[model samples]
Target chain A: MAIPDNQGGKRAADVIVTALEARITSGELENDKPLPPERDLMEEFGTSRTVVREAISSLANRGLIELRPRFRPIVRKPDYGTLLSATGTIVRYLLNEPGGVQNLYQSRVFIERGLVRDAALNATKENISDLKAALLANEKALDHSEEFFRTDIAFHGVLYRIGNNPIFPAMHEGFTSWLSPNWARMTRSDDHNRSVYLDHKAIYDAILERDPARAEEALIAHLSAAWSYVEETF
Target chain B: MAIPDNQGGKRAADVIVTALEARITSGELENDKPLPPERDLMEEFGTSRTVVREAISSLANRGLIELRPRFRPIVRKPDYGTLLSATGTIVRYLLNEPGGVQNLYQSRVFIERGLVRDAALNATKENISDLKAALLANEKALDHSEEFFRTDIAFHGVLYRIGNNPIFPAMHEGFTSWLSPNWARMTRSDDHNRSVYLDHKAIYDAILERDPARAEEALIAHLSAAWSYVEETF
Candidate 1:
């Protein structure tokens, strides 16, 4: 394969990535297959050892390949860590934009509704205990604003864990953590507090009762109110 | 802060990352703020220049900071590239597991249904036309598998763009591009051709008809059948 000139803001690493990714995605470079030696890749790509190392390192960081000492790098599938970090980054962008947080309520509503539905379907006795623990902690730490936020996160984290899907917990964690302190203060108003607390309680109760439809409805109601608050405030 | 000793199998870069991340996450260091000079940081962390540069580079690559020439590194808000790269990593992982293709169907159902719902509410005539063009390309490329898949991706891409949410398009692109082709071929059977084609037609009709509920239902039904096929195959 002819190596394209590293122009157009493309670097050696990008060249390697584009080539290797195509091969991997095309099924020509199957999983667990050892890649060409660094020297061989260097010659093929017509780059220095440093460039090849950077490319491989980048791939390894993404969990696309594993580099073992004294052996050729091996391709591995990516994982949840990659997704969590990526989602967190995206949510952070939304949080930073003007009026972005105000608009996020719709996306948040959809995710929470799905999460609550799964939680209702999958919540076991142990999961209930975990949820209760988080709720109790939240109640106890209400006076300590930061701790209150932490407990609040714990509550939602437990809910996602109980939902039986790996993707939701990370998304929840990333979104909540990225916007905690500001949202916590937003919830401090008397009207926001009463409405939010009640909505959370209703959703929690629906989960405890193992009613998927009710759980979804309660979560949606909660988010609708929350979105209204955001709209009015922002 | 006490500097943790780096042992065998851990590089100075890893140590620097752990310490810096702890400080950053704990709010000892503020977001969007610049770090101390490299010389000063190296002195404080008791690490080498190479180690400090590697640490900062890693952070920069992850969208945590931006390295400026002749100046301190500035903390950055999360950027889109990082988010896309991260999601690609997650899809890569999902492709590695047994019956991984089915999980993609689950994700598709969860994500695309919501995407099309919002798209129906938000899409412009220009966006709808772009989507139609993509669908036409998909139809024409039916005999060429690679071209068909590429156009299939473009079709979804147009839908995501129509949703007018930055998060969804980045995520949709990452998942589509990073997914394993072997896993995708599971749905390439002739039996699915008629069902998928008709579902796409219905979805297109709903979009053109500007019926949000019908659009969502059509997309969900399409994904649900895709999931069913995956389950049977696996």
Candidate 2:
């Protein structure tokens, strides 16, 4: 983790970033709340004006906080895009290491299991209806694997929406998109018809019944089998 | 979830970004791999050069890939800084909503328990030794809570390193820092001393014995109690 050096050969920016990051993360400074003015911060942290500006800029670039024109820096809410970018970075880093893919998938399964359970508990009527629509799309595309895959994802998207935690679905979707293309090619050789139908049906039944424990178990079983197939073949 | 617009007015850049993002996450492009030249990708996707360039720059800025001085853009490995940014964003967002603090603490417990479990299983002899050293540091801190807190983090950090996944520790570190400042107030109650020692000892014992199941159980119990306290107080 060799961090790049500062341009002006000063450590003030680095020190301020670290201190401010700790402050923000530790819940000392609440989200959507403003920090002290630049001048105030500079004086308080004993840093130059440039250091203060650079620290704020770095934070903004990372999407951690927003810097308004006149207002002080404030914490920002993360949307799906920020979540995915972060997921992409973590997954990519893990994938580059030796024997990282399997471990990455393992963590994905852990996260997805929890996500679906929450979705089972929290999903609204609208989300359930949308999930049903996506399932229908899946059934209609029985012969079209690509459409089936898209609809399958759309179904999960609904599941994610139902989960009600914005972070869970966004992160899950990012990893799924990363992992799915490989599985898609693998699925082509197998008898995808019966397994896909049954697995997805089990999930739908659990969701419709509002059985979170069952839903989570079914999801784990479904993905475990699917992932096992990928592991065996690919 | 309103995304920032693509620099160009049209939606083509957005489409290209989506497609390229999928490819990058799927490991189709791979870390440090060169992206196709602008002209080549444009012809393949039937999108304009501007669309492709915008997509690439967007991806780079988001930390998905990097734009080099010459030749094609390269897909770089994801790093801790990026994960921290994302985790911080998510935590901050959670903190903004009503009952958000409780929810954030719940998530913290969930993530940290899993991390400790994984860390226990993956820890090496050297990791254990390092962790022991941090524990000694903690003991020496006595009445100095700040030093104890810092060393306490080091103890867990060593465990994160043991998990054999770089991203886990990185993400954990990000969350730890994000949550640290508030921790002092949270941990300063009448019962803090006894509870912290016992819980820390339980985790330490499990790891020392290499009992993954025990380690996980202890971690969950510890976190569950802590979460209850935070929820009630914070």
Candidate 3:
């Protein structure tokens, strides 16, 4: 493959990235293979070690390659870390920039409605048991209160697991972490904890009963109640 | 701020990144302020120029800092590109791994349903006109064919504009591009074109009528039809 010479506004690393990107997407660099070593890449590209390293780092940052220090970089299946970071950053953007925290929370409602719908449609005996286990944990931990939050997050995560999609779990965790601190500040009352547990129990019962519409209804009610709390507190 | 010592597998760059991450997240490094110059950072961190640069790049990758060559790094608002890179990477992961393509399409359906519902509820005359302009352009450009796809994608993007949140558009564009090649193969027939146009028209009319439930119904129908075609073909 032909590698282009660096041009205006293009760093040497950028040029290497363009060349590597083409090779990777064109199937020349097989996913099973490691990239050429830094010394070889430096010699081949006639660039400094730092330039070659940066080029590889750029590819890694974009989730195109996996890098381990002192090892040849491996061609990688893009992973969830990229998704998690990106999602957390976007939530921060909505909170700090013009979109307001309400927009972020509303988006979460849309996503959870989809998740619970999928869980209800796809839930098996094992999935139901998993949901019950999480809820049972939540019920037992309420005395600890701090532990209430952990089980609550895990219950929603279990819903994603029933749907058998990695994407949902990644997104659920990201959205939950982003909203957690604000949610804690807004809903610290005893009444809030009781209702939160009851709302989750409703979601659990609906999923166990194999009713997607009911599950969505319970989730929407839960979100609506939470939204009211946030709006009122803020 | 106390900069932690580099230990175990942690490189000097990693040490600097940890220090910077703390200061940035704590708001000690104000968003309006650029980081200290490379020479200053190098002196402070007792690391090489390459290490300092890499640390800065790490912060930039996380959207904590913005890097411009020939300038000190500026603190930045986390932006859509980070989210886009993450999401596109995750989609790539699904395509390459046992995760399969179904997850990506299902995720898109979930997201679009939300976007269209928002568009219907929040749309104004300007938003409606934008949707109409895109639809009209699609109708007029059927012969160009490739332009047909562009307009189709643009039409959905316009829907996100009505919701007044930047996240949906970024996601729609990313997901559309990822699915474009597969969608092209599935819907190359003239029958596909006519139906696709009609489906979009249904969506536009629903939004113009300010009926969100109807808008969602049209979108779900459109997606189900498209999903069936993909499933049958691939």
Candidate 4:
């Protein structure tokens, strides 16, 4: 098939994708329903088998549909898995370029700043306790040395979970997963971990106090300090 | 070949992806070079033709490699295209859920807040003038409704460009593109457009004055006003 000839396949696929995406979003195609067979789609779009196939692939790429080998493709209720893969892919690419990782880090700061602010404004008391528990877990793990950092991450995860939208946690976790390698490379001095723990505590405290500005400030300070350590180490 | 089963294929593809990704990122395999043939990969990984082919598809899906039939797949020096697609994909999904679009909007705020802050701190005189010209374009286009909003968007685009890292602009543009459909639907009264222009001018003036705090505040105010309009209209 001459490997579908990139540009041509992409153009045809884009056409199919736009049509299908509109259908799916407008609820013309119900969620979790199977799409028509390739033969059917080929006839409907008045395109070749290769054109139809490429179009299906493009829709799959956009998380609008799922393509299975033997069965017809289906509309997808896609989730953070798609988000994580995309974020992870570009992040790895960015790590190789100048100021790339820093941009990623800056983006994380931006995301968490907003998340922390929202958590403070909207979190219930139950959510505050969860944050406290996550903080305690970090403190307990600090003695173990090996598991300390993960619980620290878990603390932020808990804070993110306080918001009504689940994507906040998912997005935060995605960046954390991508940044974990370099995270591990940083020198975690006993004092560093201890200080980090305190930073998380202060953030929790700010949220508990229902202080949005303070929560944001604490997060920015916490991230800035951690970033400084990374800079000094690397 | 029974469409390599999903989860099983995913596992196998992941293994291949990890190995090949390491090779590519490590520069053991240079960018733009064709990956080893499927037959070679099959033998190298001790996998079947179906398994190797599926693995290659996953790499291509992640934009790490591009699959070409009848020839070896090639390594991709992937760009913002992949990242933009992925961001757009997930953002579309997020827009349908509760608090989803809000989270996305908040994310944009965080990013631009940082971008504007940096621009004020770091922008060159030339960058400031470019922003001034964009603001003027927005002002001039006000009479012609269609081009007006685009020039308004271009103003932020210019601010994003002031930063050294190009990804800031790419990421902002990606979010803007995804959010634009909704942006277009809003009732842009003459008064609304005039106020928005003033907001942009304030942001520009902040940057020119080298006031990071004012820049961030102006941006937040501008976005907040826009958000309120969207909320009331919808």
lDDT to native, each model? 0.66, 0.66, 0.74, 0.75
DockQ of each: 0.17, 0.12, 0.29, 0.27
Model 1 fnat value: 0.24
lDDT (Cα, tens digit) per residue for candidate 4, span A43-133: 8888877667666665675566776655668887656555664456666776767666677787788678867877887888898888888
Runs of candidate 3 with Cα error greater than 4 angstroms are A1-48, A63-77, A86-94, A98-100, A118-126, A184-190, A206-214, A228-234, B1-47, B59-77, B86-94, B98-100, B117-130, B184-190, B206-217, B227-234
Off by more than 4 A, model 2: A1-81, A85-103, A113-144, A154-164, A187-190, A200-221, A228-234, B1-78, B85-94, B97-100, B115-142, B158-162, B187-191, B204-217, B228-234
Candidate order by lDDT, decreasing, is 4, 3, 1, 2
DockQ of 1: 0.17
* Residue-by-residue lDDT tens digits, candidate 4, B1-234: 111224433456468877988888778889999888789888999887666765666577667786654557789766655576545655676687766667778767867886787788788889988988999999998877788888988888887777655666776677777677677778878888899999999998998899988998999999999898667656
lDDT of 1 by residue, B1-234 (tens): 111112254666767866776566555778779987778889988987767866776665455665544557776555444555444444654666664555555665767766676667677889888878887887877766667667767778787676565666666755565543444757565445545667787888898887877997898887777556556554
TM-score for each predicted model, relative to the true structure: 0.60, 0.57, 0.74, 0.71
Please give fnat for model 3: 0.33
| Model 1 vs truth, CA RMSD | 9.4
Task: List TM-score (chain A only) for every prediction.
Answer: 0.63, 0.63, 0.76, 0.72
Name the lDDT of candidate 2: 0.66
User: How big is the RMSD of model 2?
Assistant: 10.2
Pairs of colliding residues, candidate 2: A25-B178, A26-B178, B32-B75
Q: What root-mean-square deviation over C-alphas does model 3 reach?
A: 6.0
Best of the candidates, TM-score = 3
Interface RMSD of each: 8.2, 7.6, 7.5, 7.7
- Clash count, one per candidate: 1, 3, 0, 1
